[model samples]
Each structure stands twice: as structure tokens, then as C-alpha cells.
Target: MTDTQDELPQLMSHQSFREQAREVIRGMIVSGKMAPDALYSAPKIASDLNVSATPVREALLDLVQEGLLRPVRNRGFQVVIMTAKEHDDVFKIRLLLEVPSIREIAKSSPTANQMKGLYDLANAARQFAREGDLIAYLNADRRFHISLIELLGNKPLTELVASLRDRVRLLGLANSGARSHIVQSATEHFELLDRIAASDTESAAAIIERHLRRSRDVWGAGSGPA
Candidate 1:
């Protein structure tokens, strides 16, 4: 190791460093600061994060297992690239899983506080869209939709949805070049919230499905495998 590498935090038996490193790297990838297909060098990452390369290497391995990154033969890791079919498959599963959960929440008639929280998140997403903050908008959008499903009180289902969401974030960030897309998403969010607040489970489910479909369509049109 170089002198700089020697200065990094010593890797103890604890696992928190690896977890924190994974989150940091994942955030960079999700936020578009780290381009897809770019090589991930442990030394560079350690230098940038001011940590030992061991945690960065461990985190990269974890991401690879999670399908977020892939190891190249005789080279460093690279961010995973998704085909259009993969993207469609992901969204299809999301619709199948998440739509029903949201419907359940609507049917259960969530408390006023719950509904308010969802609407507040939607409003924040819209504000981010209006300001052209794609990262904030995407994060808030995920929070709103995921929170809706979380209210259904299914731990396994929520875990599955969260896993799918990581993949969705990749596609959303890739398609952030189009401004109109954000506007359309914001409109859909408002409509969904309105339907939910009215306690219309059927309409809320339909609207949520439509939103996911439209998102797939728009993202497919913008960036997909050839």
C-alpha cells in the first residue's frame, strides 16, 4: 500500500465500515455522480472516501452480489448495465407486488396522519421536480410510493419492493435528461394522492398501475438496451 493508503482506517473485525462504504458508493451511483460502466478503482475510491481499500473492496463485492455491479475479467468492477427487457421485467414485478399492497392500504383507510405523510412526500417530490432536482425528486418519489406499500405491514413484501426500487433508481437516473418526464411523474403523483385521500381503492390502484406503466414507457423510449 502507498503512504496514502496507510492513512486509511484500519479494517477491524467489525462490519460497520463495509456497510457504510457500500451505502456511500451506492449513493454516488444512484445520484449519477458515478457513471454507469465506469470502472471502480478501490484505490481511487479509498482516496476519495478517506477510508481503507478493504472496506471499499468488500462493499463492491456486496454490490456485485446484489446485481448492482459486475466484476470484469482482469479489471476492476463496473456498474451493472440493464437491458430494456430487464427494466420492463422489474417494473412488471413492482406493479404486481406494490399495486396490491397500496390497494390494501387504501382499502384499510389509512389514518389522516398516514395520508398526510404520503401527500407531503408527493408535494416534496413535485417541488423537487419543479426545481429540476432530479435526485431529490427521485428519492422523494421512491419514499412516497414505498411508504404507501409499507403501510400494508408486510415485511417480506416491503423488502422485495425495496430491492426492486434500487434497480428502478438506476433507470430513473438514466432517463433524467428529459425534463417533461418529471412533470408527467409529478402529475401522476398528485392524481394518485387525490385518489388515495378519497378512499377509492380501485381508482388508486388503477392510477398507480398507470403511473408505473407510463414510467416504463417513457424510460424505455429514452434509454434501453439496443
Candidate 2:
């Protein structure tokens, strides 16, 4: 066979590899293993993940489109690094979109089953945090917060909030060493649920806003852009 024919199998294998590589990188971003502003090398990632360079390149390209990574001048891609001002701006917008939506759900007075599910998610998140399982904690925490909006019946708002929440996850992982913050966050969820259960829209909204703001504050203090 010719040289081109010799390369065909490797090319075909790579074609099937990029999809899985993309997912692995996305998971690392979401789980905070790869932090914001951290530099990434395609070859290094490929070696680490036991794949070829082709898939790593494809995965990085996908992340760039998703706004999770960006190219650096004459170098590799870096995690999308947000400044403090940018983080604050996003946090404010998130509060505007999510707090009221959560309040509306609170006002609707969801069934016991609905509230129980959220509580269960919160409990699971707390356990994950206590165990120092960052990935599990991140997933469970996302579920706990998004569950409130999901209960509100706002699909569009939920999608938007989820995107913004992805950015916040970076900050959360940066400051994940703060045990108090984790405990406080878990406790706040219970309080927010209590307010929701009581159908106190005003208090519930206030609680959520405060919860998000405090999280931003704590994470921002240490993890803000350098």
C-alpha cells in the first residue's frame, strides 16, 4: 500500500475520537479541573487523555465556539478568563433573570413531590461537598439551583441561566477550598426551599438574590481576575 493508504486507518480512528475528546474537555471545564485562564496544549491534552492530537484540536475548537476557551497569540488556547467586573456584570444579569423566576415558582406553591426533589438534590450536593468530590458536587449543585427554575416552567430562562451558571462554575472551583462557603451554600438552599414552601415570593426572591450575591462575593474575593 502507498503512504496515503497507510495513514487511512489512523485518520479514521481520529475521526471517531474527536467527539469523545470534546466531551471529556467539556466535562473538565464544567467540573473545574481545567480552570479559567489556565493554558492548554493540544499535544499535552491528547497524551494525558490517551488520544491523538487530531481529537484534542477538534475538542479545543468546539470549546472556542462555546465561549469556554479562547486562542492565545502564538500559543495554545486558554480557559476563558473573566475579569472581576465581567463576573459582577454576569452575576447581576443572572440575578435579574433567575431570582424572579424562582420567586414565581415559590408563589405557585409547588407540590410536596416537587419540593422534595429539590431538597434531595441539595442534600446530595452537601454530601458531595463534604466528601470533597468536586465533580459530583458541581453536578449536584447545578441540579439544585436549576431545579428551582425548572419548577417555574421557564425553559428559555433556564437555558440562559444555565449558560451563565457555567461561567460561575469556574469561580466555584477556584474557591472550592473554602469549607465554610460550601456549608453556607448548602444551608442557604434549605432556607430558600423553606421560603418557597411557604409561598413567600418576596422573601424567596430576596433569599436567592442574597445567596447568589454572597457566592459571587466570596468567590470573587479570592478568585477574581488577576
Q: Which candidate gets the maximum TM-score versus the true structure?
A: 1
Give the whole-model CA lDDT for all candidates, comma-separated.
Answer: 0.73, 0.74
How well is each residue in 1-226 modelled by candidate 1, as lDDT tens digits?
2323332344344667788677666655555556675787877877766778897889988878877778887778887877777877888899898788767777888899988898889899889889876655666776777788788788888777877877765643545444677767887988987887788999999998888877767653666475
Candidate 2 to truth, TM: 0.74
Distance (Å) between predicted and true CA of 59, model 2?
A: 6.3
Task: List candidate 2 segments past 4 Å from native.
Answer: 1-27, 30-32, 35-38, 41-65, 71-76, 171-177, 223-226
Off by over 4 Å in 1: 1-33, 42-62, 72-75, 169-177, 220-222
Per-residue lDDT for 22 in model 1? 77
- Give Cα distance to truth, residue 197, candidate 1, Å: 2.1
- Clashing residue pairs in candidate 1 are none
lDDT of 2 by residue, 1-226 (tens): 1212221122235346786676556656755567565677888777776667987898899878777789887688888877777777888899889888887888899999998898999899889778765555666787788887888677888877877887765544445445677777888888999999999999999999998888777654676565
Per-residue error (Å), model 2, residue 5: 35
